[model samples]
Structures are given as structure tokens and as C-alpha cells.
Target: MNRQESEAHVLREATADDVHLMLSWRNQETNRHVSKTSHEITAEEHARWWSAVRDDPSRRVLMYVREDLPCGVVTFFDLRLESPRSGAWGFYLDAEGLDGRGETLPAWLGVMREAVEYAFDGLHLDRLDGEVLGHNTVVRQMNRRFRFVEGTPRQELSDGREITVIPISLARTDRRQR
Candidate 1:
């Protein structure tokens, strides 16, 4: 299923059973556009990563479910609890027939809103930030809509062409509106 099929999607905690399925989706070209992957991940690698991921209290990986079908993933890392309450995040959708431009963008916005709220409220983090590819207009638009201020132009993760690193931050004042 794709974005069209994810209208009634549910965001749930990821599990050991969903590793391979998540890998298949993450490998899609649309997803790989901004993802860091040179090759497919091995099952063994996934297991090891999942083990470490599950054991890390500062991280969270959630699965987006559509009509009981798993369709996407979103993960947050590098959580710090002291003066800065924030974490970094990344994700991609796997619903096969859905349009990234039409359906996935909106879905991602809602998920991102919730994720930010969780970071500030539940985790008591003061900020949340992330980097998006300069070529990925759809994602950039979403981040802008979510009040993620654009940062300086940087070649931080560019595959070849210079990619601007866009950062989104959420502060306590920002959360008060929600």
C-alpha cells in the first residue's frame, strides 16, 4: 500500500517482526533519495541494529500501519536531556502505490507534529532538529510548514551535488501553541 492507502494509517511502535519488511521499504528509490544506504542491509545487520536500538533508552523507532498493513518508519536518535531537550530524526514511507507528493507529505506532517510533541512533552526535550536533502522539495516544504527554520547552506550529506541542510527546531514556546 502507498500513501493513498495510508489514509487510515496507524503509527505503532516497531518490533522485531517488522525488521525485514522495514528494510524492503527503506530500499525503495523514493526513500533512498535522501537515506544513507550504499547497499541493502543484511538480516544479521538489521538484527544487531534492532537489538542496540531497542536497548537504547534515548531512541524510538515507530511503524506506520495502514489498515493493519505496515507502510512506513520514523526513528529519532541522539537524545540529550540536560540543558538541551532535543533529538534528531529520520524516516521514509513504503506504501507501494501512494504518491509521495500527494499523500505521503501530509501523512508525514501529522506524524512529524506528533513526534515533535512527544520530544518536547514526553521526553521533556527542549528541541528537535533534522537534516533534509536540498533536492527533496516535498520534504523541505513539510519541514517549513512545521515551523522548521531553514539553516545555512551546507554540503553535510550531499551525495555529489551540493545539498543544503535544512534544520527544524521546536522550543518550549513553540509547544505552548499546541
Candidate 2:
């Protein structure tokens, strides 16, 4: 599909069947290298983790689907339903399905737009925070496009190597201005 057509993608709550696919995507080399923890996850670990968050009221795990195919996963955690209405979120797209097919940019843009809308409009969140590995310039730029302002940077270990992670946040008002 073309960029415009791909923009019609949807994000739905992830189901039990998605656990394997999501785990595979999360364990991909590129995804691991850019994540906070780079260790490969075993099926048992994934199952345990999935079971913990699957029914957590403070978390939302969603799958991005386009043309009836899964393209990515988006997750929101640490949801504070009280005053601030803030949360932390992260996402990753299927490289083989989207990027390898030369639809990376558009697919990412569409999924991210939907994710942001879901955060603000559906969840009524006042702000959404994200942390990106310093080396992931593409995602940092994408965050800018979505009006995510960069915050403080911190050091963390990924794959046994020290790496920087920069925090970014998007406020409801900021998104409205966009």
C-alpha cells in the first residue's frame, strides 16, 4: 500500500495470540541494541512478563495492524489515573514487514500518530513520556515530529556497554497545538 493508504492503519489491544510475535520483534537484534536491556528473552521469561502486564489496569499493550497484517506494538505503562494523568510509553515496528518492504517511514509515522491520539484522546493523558537510546537518531527525530520535547539524559547499560538514554515527553496541550 502507498503511504496514504498505510495511514489508515489501526491500533487494537494486543491479544494472547500476539505474545509470540511481539516477543520475536522485541528480541530482534536491532530492537535489542536500541533498548534499555539488550539480553535475549526466553519464552518462559516472556510468558511470565506477559502474564504480569496483560491484565494490569495501569498498562495498555496494543498491536498496530495495517491491511490485516501486524506491523508493530505500542505499550503504555505507569499510568497514573489521578491528577497528572501521565504515563510512559514505548513502541517498535516490524522491520521485515514494514522497513524491509521500503515502507518504514510512512508506517512509523502512521502508527505513531495513532498512538499519540490514543494517549491523549482515548486515555485522556495529560502527558506521555518516552525514553530513547541516544544512538537511535531516527526515533529521536520522529519524537520531534510528534512534538516530544527532549529532557535530561542518563547513562545506562545495554548489551554490557554503557549507553545514553534521553527522556522525551509530549504534553496534551502541545499535541493540541500541533
TM-score of 1: 0.78
TM-scores, all models, native as reference? 0.78, 0.92
List residue ranges in candidate 1 displaced over 4 A: 1-10, 95-97, 100-103, 157-164, 175-178
Candidate 1 clash pair list: 1-95, 1-96, 2-95, 2-98, 3-98, 85-125, 85-126, 85-127
lDDT tens per residue, model 1, 40-154? 5677777788889987978889886655656678788998877866788777877454564356655665567556666676677777777777778877787767677667656
Local distance difference test, each candidate: 0.69, 0.88
- Writing each residue's lDDT as its tens digit, candidate 2 over 39-79 gives 99999999998999999999999999886789899999999
